[model samples]
Target: MPDVTKAIASDIFSGRYPAGSSLPTENELGVEYGVSRTVIREALKVLAAKGLVLSRPRVGTVVCNEDDWNIIDPQVLAWHAPHALDDKLFDAILET
Candidate 1:
């Protein structure tokens, strides 16, 4: 269960889903991952609690804006820190 949650979080952070995009339906995800809908639901809940996604009635789950994400959460921070530093290095190089 935790593994699924982390894997989904990693995918989200890697831009596989991108912010503001609706996630695949629970049924779709379950079929794709070979898990039950309940597992997919649990994973979605994990993301929602981290502020990376939001669940709405009828509309299902959608990724939150990057600004709304819990940027300081250890897992989230680990995922983005390297990319942020790389961006900074690129910016410095561009100024030369």
Candidate 2:
């Protein structure tokens, strides 16, 4: 579960699924990862609590903007930095 959460977190931070983009449904993710929807939802809850994602009714889960991200969190910044190659994102992360 932790591995899945971290992988999902890394994917979100990497912009594999950009802000405002809907992620795979819990069921889809569960099938892809060979986990249950319960585990997927719990992982997503962790991300949401970390301000890395927004889960809304009918909209699914979406990555949050930089402003919405927990930039002050070293773990979050570190997660985002290595995967983010864009100059703008790098600058933003550094600035934070």
Assess every candidate by TM-score.
0.77, 0.79
Query: Model 2: which ten-residue window has the lowest total lDDT?
Result: 84-93
Candidate closest to the true structure, highest TM-score:
2
TM-score of 2: 0.79
Per-model lDDT: 0.78, 0.81
Candidate 1 Cα outliers beyond 4 Å, as residue runs? 79-96
Over 30-54, each residue of candidate 1 has an lDDT whose tens digit, in order, gives 8878899999999888789889999
RMSD of each: 5.5, 2.4
Give candidate 2 regions above 4 Å deviation: 85-96
- Candidate 2 displacement at residue 6 in angstroms: 0.9
Displacement of residue 32 (Cα, Å) in model 2 is: 1.8
Q: Write the per-residue lDDT of candidate 2 for residues 3-45, one digit (tens) a residue.
A: 7887888888777888888899999999988999999999999
